[model samples]
Target: MNAFEINGGKPLRGEIIPQGAKNEALQVISAVLLTEEQVIISNVPDIKDVNKLIELLGDLGVRVEHLKKDTYSFQAKDIDLDFFMSEQFKAKGGSLRGSIMIVGPLLARFGKASIPKPGGDKIGRRRLDTHFLGFEKLGAKFNYNSKTNFFNVDASHLKGAYILLDEASVTGTANVIMAAVLAKGITTIYNAACEPYIQQLCKMLNRMGAKISGIGSNLLNIEGVEKLGGTEHRLLPDMIEIGSFIGLAAMTGSEITIKDVHYNELGIIPDIFKRMGIRLKLRGDDIYIPSQPHYEIDTFIDGSILTVADAPWPGFTPDLLSIVLVVATQAKGNVMIHQKMFESRLFFVDKLIDMGAQIILCDPHRATVMGLDKQVQLRGIEMTSPDIRAGVSLLIAALSASGRSIIHNIEQIERGYQDIDIRLRALGADIKRINTMPKQH
Candidate 1:
């Protein structure tokens, strides 16, 4: 296993550019399978999850080319349908949750799709019932194989239908949209996820000759087309990374500029940080955070303690609540973090408490953090990362601690962030990557 040894208490200075959105890239790359022509995608993050999905594409005989750094072109003209039933796919497809999205495009173009049980962070119960239910709504036959643990969907002919999703699940909506784009009639999706990633997917599909309207709203209208053509798409900068940078600046007392953020699309992220009393300024397309000796948390107007929580789109994302909780540890007041989406995301606060942060885990979904206000610096300690968001949160906590900290299970971190150690080192962070071999009994 590999760990990061971070010597903290130094302010990071310089510019850091956010990588491409991981969620968006997954959906966009999956859409390439809908058409046989070459589809070029730019600004794709070279993270483990994405690389694993790309490898899965290669296993399916999709011709993938690396045109340049963070750019790739995919041609699915010669895809090997047999690969989906191979033992190799059973292993690879179950490795990442994003692998489940392949079912949409594969079913659209090949009339059949199957995926083994998907695996990702053990945050909570991430059910695929939303996905399979959507497929069943579109006249597809859905079956599950208990022995192989695979969910299979087959459709001799797909006809569009009205789908009212149980929840606005992002991946579910994307998968259903991909399937609907090549159906035989109009498909109307109500209560769909309207995240920027989903909006981008709808726009890209439109560019590829699929007629999709209501790009930024919860109700989407997709007109089925006979076929789709190749089109080039560019991914948006990762909003989660940008939010992490904001927290890092406040926690480490750093002056950092996050470059090329699509600020207009980042609905309430900036304002949310501002509520935490972090000083942020917009410079063109960049977010500049100056060094601060102390940041204070704001209370509600009626004199109640401040609370930050996550919701669906146009609201705070559940992904950044961990970052927000970590940043609140050093603020000059108290704040309540409500992680509405995932039940177990706040469990990592116990590790932060071991490092001298004042946190009260109210339950599986709520935490109350009493900020230190720079009265005392957090002392470093050895810990293990739990999930992607929590891993980055721990890294931020380690960066601001008074002494050296060791974090294990860094693979969780690498699955999302691209070259994180190198990027932080460029900003003067004292982080080192070390691999340790297990001891024999």
Candidate 2:
């Protein structure tokens, strides 16, 4: 296993650029399968999950060309549908959660697709009912084999229909949109996820000849096109990474600048950090976080304790709650973190507690953190990374803590953050990657 050894208490400096959106890349790259013509995508992050999806595409006979660094051209002119039945496909496709996305485009264009139970961070029970229900609404036949944990979908003729999602799931919306774009008639998706990534997907699909309206709202209308043409797309900067950097800067008391952040699309992230009293500035498109000796959390106007909860787009994102929780550890006041979407996300607070931060894990979904206000510095200890967000949260805590710390299962962090050690190194972070040897029996 690979681990990160971090020497803490040193503040990071210099400018850092956020990586291309991993979530957006997954959606847009999967959309390439909708067209037989070449589709070029830029700003694709060189991370494990995205690379695994690209490899799966190549394995399915999609002509993939690495045009340049972070740019690729894909043409699914001769997709080998037969490969879906191969053991190779089973092994590769089942390994990535994003691999489930390829199913929509494959079903839309070629009339059928199958994927084994997709794998990803063990945060919670992420149900696939939304995707399948949306597909079935678009006239697709769905089947799940409990014996093999495989899902198969097929639609000889997809006819668009109105769909009110049980929840505004981003990936589910993307999948349904991809399927409905090629169906006959109009598809109205109500209570849809309208995050910037979803809007980007809809905009890219429109450029590829899809008729989609309501770009940035919960309601979307898509009119089916016979076939889509190729289009080039550039992914937005990863807002999650940007948020992480903001937390990193605040936790370490580092005056750092994050470049090319696409400010307007950040939603409530900046405001949320500001609520924590982390002083930041918006210069052009960059976020400049000044070194803070002490930051305080803001209570509600009624003097109640501050509560930060995750909601859909236009609301605080659940992904950044971990960072917020970590940043709150050193702030001047107390705040409650309500992770409504995922129950197990707040469990990582135990690691933070071990590091000498004052945190109360109230339950599976709630944690109340009392900031030490820099009066007490967190002393590091060995820990295992539980998930992607939690891993980076621990990394940020380690960077700001007093002693040396070792974090195992860094692969979770690498799955999302690109060249994290190298990037933090550019900003003068005392962190390095090390391979741990297997235990000898």
Candidate 3:
């Protein structure tokens, strides 16, 4: 494992290029299983989860060839469904929520599919009901084995029907859409997850010659294609990384500019952060974050404390909540951070509070942060990462602390941020990445 040692209280000031979107890449890579044709995806981020997923796909018998640093071409001409149905399946694909998506597409195409329990951020209980609900509506029978932690979906010539998801579960919507894209008849997904992730998946499917209507809307009408052929598509820039950078610049009191961000693709992220008293300059496709010597949270019209919350698309991303929560600690005023998607997410505030941050954990999903305390600063200390987002948040907190800090479990941080230590060090942050060994007993 690797750990980051950060000497804090340093202002990070430099131009940082955001990496490719991890969430979008996860779904885009899985889209390869939809066709055996050669699919070339570019601008891919080099991260643990993405690499692990690529490894899982390789295990599935997909011919994955690296074209360049951030580009790869894959052809699933030799997809072995049995690879995903083994005991190893429980330890492999079931560990990633994205891998579970393979089941729906495989079942629709091969008439049978098996997947182990899916894994991702252990933020909270994110169920696959919406996904299975979509599968059942598409004429597939799901046999979930709790003991084996596998889902066996079998069906012959799936007949599409009206499919409405319970929630806009991102992966669920993706899995359902993948299955329905090649069904016998029309499939309608109501109240679907239309985030950038789902949008990119729909676009990739469309580029591959699948008839999917409502590219950016909740009602997705996937007209089952006879067969999807391979077509090349570029992965979207990592918007979450972009947002994370925005928060990082604000907290560091640095005037940093982000280059090559598709401003239009970001929806309302720029405007939402403005509510936190973070002003950004959007010129063409780039974003400029100016240094704020006295950063503060903006109050509501009636003088109530500002509250930053996350919602579906056209709203702030839940992934960036941890970053924003840390940023709020340095802002001038108080603001409540509400993360409805995950419960364990807000638990990291205790670690922040230990560093002298005035964060009141109202509950499992909400935290009230009183910033700066007029004369207080977060001091650096040694800490362990609990999850990916929290790990990155701790890194940000460590950078802003008064002294040196050591962060363990950097693999969690690496799972999302691509070359994060190098990227942050470029911005004048004294961060060093070193491989660590467990203490011998």
Alpha-carbon runs more than 4 Å astray in model 2: 437-441
Over 1-441, each residue of candidate 3 has an lDDT whose tens digit, in order, gives 778889988887878888888888887888888888999999999998888889888988999999999999999889877676577666877667667766766876788888877887778887878877788888888888988888888878788789878888888888888888889889988998888778888988998888899988999988898888897878778888888888888777788899999888888788767877888998777899988777668888999988888898777788888988998898888999999988899888878988889999999989999898336778987787878889888888888788988888777788888999888888999999777764332
lDDT leaderboard ranking: 2, 1, 3
The RMSD (Cα, Å) of candidate 1 is: 1.5
Evaluate model 3: give its TM-score: 0.96
Q: Please, what is the whole-model Cα lDDT of each candidate in the order they appear? A: 0.94, 0.94, 0.84
Model 2, TM vs. native? 0.99
**lDDT of model 2, residue 215:** 85
Candidate 2 Cα deviation (angstroms), residue 415:
0.2
The sequence of per-residue lDDT tens digits that candidate 1 reaches over residues 1-441 is 899999998999999999999999999999999999999999999999999999899889899999999999999999898887899999999889999989999888889988999999989989898888888888899899999899888977888999999998999999999999999999999989999999999999999999999989999998999999999999999999999999999999999999999999999999999999999999999999999999999999998999999998988999999999999999999999999888888899988999999999999999999999978899988888889999999999999999999888899999999999999999999999998642232
- The better candidate by lDDT, 1 or 3, is 1
Better of 2 and 3 by lDDT: 2
Tell me each candidate's TM-score: 0.98, 0.99, 0.96
Report the number of backbone clashes for model 3.
Answer: 5
What is candidate 1's CA lDDT for residue 57?
95
Model 2, span 118-191: residue lDDT tens: 99998998989999999999999989999887898889899989999999999999999999999999999999
Q: Candidate 3 — which pairs collide? A: 21-238, 94-117, 94-118, 95-119, 296-332
